[model samples]
Target: MTLLAPGSAQVVAGNRRVGMMALRIAGAVVLLVAVAALVGLLWRPFAFWAAFNPTLLGVLRWTLIGLAVGWAFLFMDAWRLGQPLSLQQNQRLAVVGINGVLCLSVAGALIFGAHVVGVQRDFTIAMSSDGAASAAEDGRYNVLLVGGDAGKGRWGLRTDSMTVASIDEETGRTVLISLPRNMTNFPFAEGSVMDKAWPQGYNCGYPDCELNSVNTWVGENRELFKGVEDPGMNATISAVEGITGLKINYWAMVNLEGFKGLVDAVGGVRLNVRQPIPVGLPNEKTFHYIDPGTRTLNGHDTLWFARAREGSDDYSRMARQKCVMNAMLHQVSPKTMLTNFTEIASASSDMVSTNVPSSEFGRFIDLALKARGQKVSTVSLVPPAVDTSDPDIDKIQEMIQKGIDQAEGTAKAAPKKKKPAGQSGMTGGSLGSLSEGYVANQADDLGAAC
Candidate 1:
């Protein structure tokens, strides 16, 4: 009887209706699970439905919770129907223990799944952006990566590092375009509010107007961008779009100070250090330096490694920041992510604010997985190529287009030339003695260049 029906013992004991109802419920659940599995096998539809619909996700979470409770109750009832009281003590104990273990295992997994769903729900709610999802334009999705800092006593926020990562829609090949923070006399996009406000460019008459200063300026005069969700961000985007000659799809701002916590959460990032880097201001009584070599850096040290300016200029710092970004892209593995998922999520929610909507996470995740296997190229609008102080906008756009073409395989990259030893290959300008192997502004392969 027990072999034919799960609740047959109860039926044999004359609770016929109850036993039949339990069996029906169990059969229905198994059928439902099988159907769900089949649906999951056709993953595209499932992924689209799951990724875009918050209500469906919530319903699924509750369904799992309900199934877990119902299954536990059914298992316990089946055990009760077995008539353990009439069995020998050892046999009864064995049956009871087996049922208990099975119940606990299934319930534990379901509860953990429910917890993960709750975490994802909270994350989506907290981080969902105002921007709408859109397709890649002209075979690329150009995203602005802004490194913002709102340090102690600093008014508002300053975006000191700005890079545009243009990713190929099909191949996942990426080219990072790094703009100098101090670049001046750059145009904002025509018809943009920023352009209307300062038709002559982001020039403030004197030499104080710079690319980085645009954020602060926008913040001071927010009324100029009456309907903008983020005035500073919009202004910066206009400047970047004008400079790069690429349509800006979305932007993500990372708080540099909060970045420390994220690095720690990922355990740490491994970097191949070419030279010793100062960690703090030279004027301070005591300062520490990160010894040169291949080493993993903690959050605090990594921040300094990326932003230290005591013995380095902003250009050198930019080069280091690129190295750091490259290392993070390459070294942090899926296993590391799963191991520290909660910490990483918590830290990221605090660290990053982006206009890339939550619904698009799946798409980006797929792109990131694709990117892992591809070589990343870089082009910077610094020195030799374009003057940071007074840039030639047309020439700058041409350089950027050249890089894009090279990445797309429409044009081959120029051959590398060897530089004489003991001489700085590129002009470091006021920034003295860049780190060894620091290839400024241009590289076919960023990892190898650093």
Candidate 2:
């Protein structure tokens, strides 16, 4: 998925206006020629000039009048676009505001092109976990949630991890596919088989080619693809798209740096840490330490919390990412965003980039509004005994595929009644009473990742 910058709209709209102007100029030239011919023909007044008609003068008169009217309207449109900035409006703010609206309009048209070419930035985020999107008849939409560290130098942050989220809207079911960065042969673009895609060395030059290195990969590849066709982030999108065998409807590439600002703007977030975890800078010796369990973290600490992986393995960190996601969602109230608009926007200036069209924001808003009162379930892939040692990578993929299929079926049947206490977690969880077959063989397959 590729997200063109908002300024791209100005370029497109400018080109379109230029094209229209050229056409109008051509039309004017044609009219002038006709007028010249008519004047010559009418010069011989003795030869029944106005006998059959108004000597062609009337037609020419009307054409010029119409042209004037059209130009007047075009001028008015330009004036409207150039509406004077308010006295209180800073020049920068006015420029950004006008261009933002224009960019959104252009992005709307870009949606069609994106669909055809498999490029997009905005993704439909299922706010509620009943994952209704996955159950939709339109085929479950699987999205790759990539936290790209594009603005490391500009904003001083790096993408922590990559997680795949699939939603079946029809059945309100969702499954999170978490891929450990170091899980060798985690599937890149080079080979047909997963094993064939693994890097020769795990660290792979400190990130660019490594499975787990976050900072190196984004920065290096972005530079590498600067001149290549469909290069840079699109390569990452393609690799993930191939891995999941699902069209990436939308993608939101969040900048890690802005996350802290966003969190701070939202007045910080509260999380119940299960246990104290050490937090610190990354190094081979004496790393930082962070104690966990029920703590309200500030912006910087929040970054440390989410990015820390010194002591625990990737799986635990995946859970931490989910926790951060949940916290952000819980606090992502319109009031919060509105209050911190400037701060949030400033933080996001270079921190995030996405290909999602601004148009789809409404669709997601509508869906969220509908599911506002429903229950949400969050699941990870690591629980219920995952067989990571299995040599057959296809088996794991197929298992996930099957679970997705069954989950879709279940979501479509009916909303499962809220189970009583002690029934929410995986085991003995109510299958929503819609159908038993959907849950029987599938629950086991879903493992703890459902």
User: Which candidate number would show the highest TM-score if scored against the true structure?
Assistant: 1
For residues 44-70, what per-residue lDDT tens digits would candidate 2 score against the true structure? 332223221232434544544454444
lDDT of 2 at 290: 49
Worst-scoring 10-residue span by lDDT in model 2 = 119-128
Error of 2 at 141 (Å): 3.2
lDDT of each: 0.78, 0.47
- Candidate 1 lDDT over 296-393, as tens digits, reads 99998898888887656777778778888888888888799878877887888888888888777767766776787877888888866677777999
TM for candidate 1 is 0.87
Candidate 2 total steric clashes? 39
Steric overlap count per candidate: 0, 39
Give lDDT for model 1.
Answer: 0.78
